[model samples]
Target: MQRVKPGDGRALKRFRWWQSLSRALFHLRLMDGDSGQTVYSVDVRHQQHSSSSGRVVAHLYLDGRHHAESTVPAVFPVQGGTVEVRASTVGLKRCHYVTAEGAEFQLVPDPASAEGRRARLDRSHPALSRCMGFLSGTVLVVGVVLLALQLAEQITRDPEGVAQYAGTLTSPIDLSGWANTVVGLCTVAASTERALRLRYNWLLDGAAG
Candidate 1:
């Protein structure tokens, strides 16, 4: 991680209502023994419209002032621990403080952000939250299975000489154009829902994204 020079004195930008779709903020607090408590915040702006590289930067703030900034996955040294930040295509995938002894704590999302709203829902309605999570996973699973079947059918449709080595295989389920479009839409929604909770899987969510 690149460290911003000390005394740089850059101010952290205030979160705007419109930027909620493309920005994220999270906070962490730690006790500093005799010094009492210390506060740290992380701010990330999505680079979807700004950069071709698709990489976003995470800014670390001490108390409420800008301390350092680095392109994620970023690790910033803090009191008694390090703040780790990572981002996915749709949203954040990780933001936690790792202690010297290996303990990890997720930073609290800003109440105005989408992630914070999701976390609030999880706290207020655990059962509904669980059901939603299950639904997201099921949708992704169905999407992946359908994708695999479609690919198999396409490959086997024109096997050519390869049919001799591996017999042609056909997909059992055939989806109409509209049905496929629906599935694609659902997959995107599921991935977005998972992203709001900072939940990501390399195979399932990765493929969906």
Candidate 2:
């Protein structure tokens, strides 16, 4: 009969790395506003019956809700990278945008979230500037053509009102007025849109949109 030795190959550590199964790791991040986007992250590890000093993975919970058990992996697991999880505020009276684990990290610590908004006058100003250049060029071309046609028609025969009207509309004074007006209009529209969106975002996270 063969005799087994003490602490031999038959003896094994229950939580040994070799004996543990590979598990999916994860982390967490949360949003603090209406968009419910990710704002923060947490590190965690597998919830297995092993050494407490094993690999680290993230554990997640949505808005203080019991979304998962203690051993369940988070939505975005990461071994040595960043995790992304949203702070869900659904089914609450006036959702408070907050992470399930931490405080707010706003754009400047005023309230708790970033004001994802752009100044209207600043927003469409560039586009208007670019479009103004284009429209100016179009007007120049049309004006030149009209001027040439009018000159030819008048120089050879009786002149008509079409040339004058075309010239006036494409003139420097008219073009400048139109460009400025267009820029102002677009600036207003873009700025308003940015403001509205930002306000909605702020209501939840308590920051400027």
The C-alpha TM-scores of every prediction are 0.88, 0.17
**Each candidate: what lDDT?**
0.84, 0.30
Supply every candidate's count of residue pairs whose N, Cα or C atoms clash at under 3 angstroms. Answer: 0, 16
Worst ten in a row by lDDT for model 1: 1-10
Off by over 4 Å in 1: 2-8, 48-54
lDDT of 1 at 115: 84
* Model 2 C-alpha lDDT per residue in residues 118-170, reported as the tens digit of each score: 22323558686456444434443444444454455554442356554543332
Instruction: Give the alpha carbon lDDT tens digit for every residue of 1-209 in model 1.
Output: 46333424477677777877799999998888887888898988885332543457788888888887777788898998799988877888899999999999999998888888899999999999999999999999999999988887777776575555677877889899999999999998899899889899998888887
The segments of candidate 2 whose C-alpha lies over 4 angstroms from its true place after superposition are: 1-124, 158-209
Highest lDDT among the candidates is held by which one? 1
lDDT of 1 at 110: 88
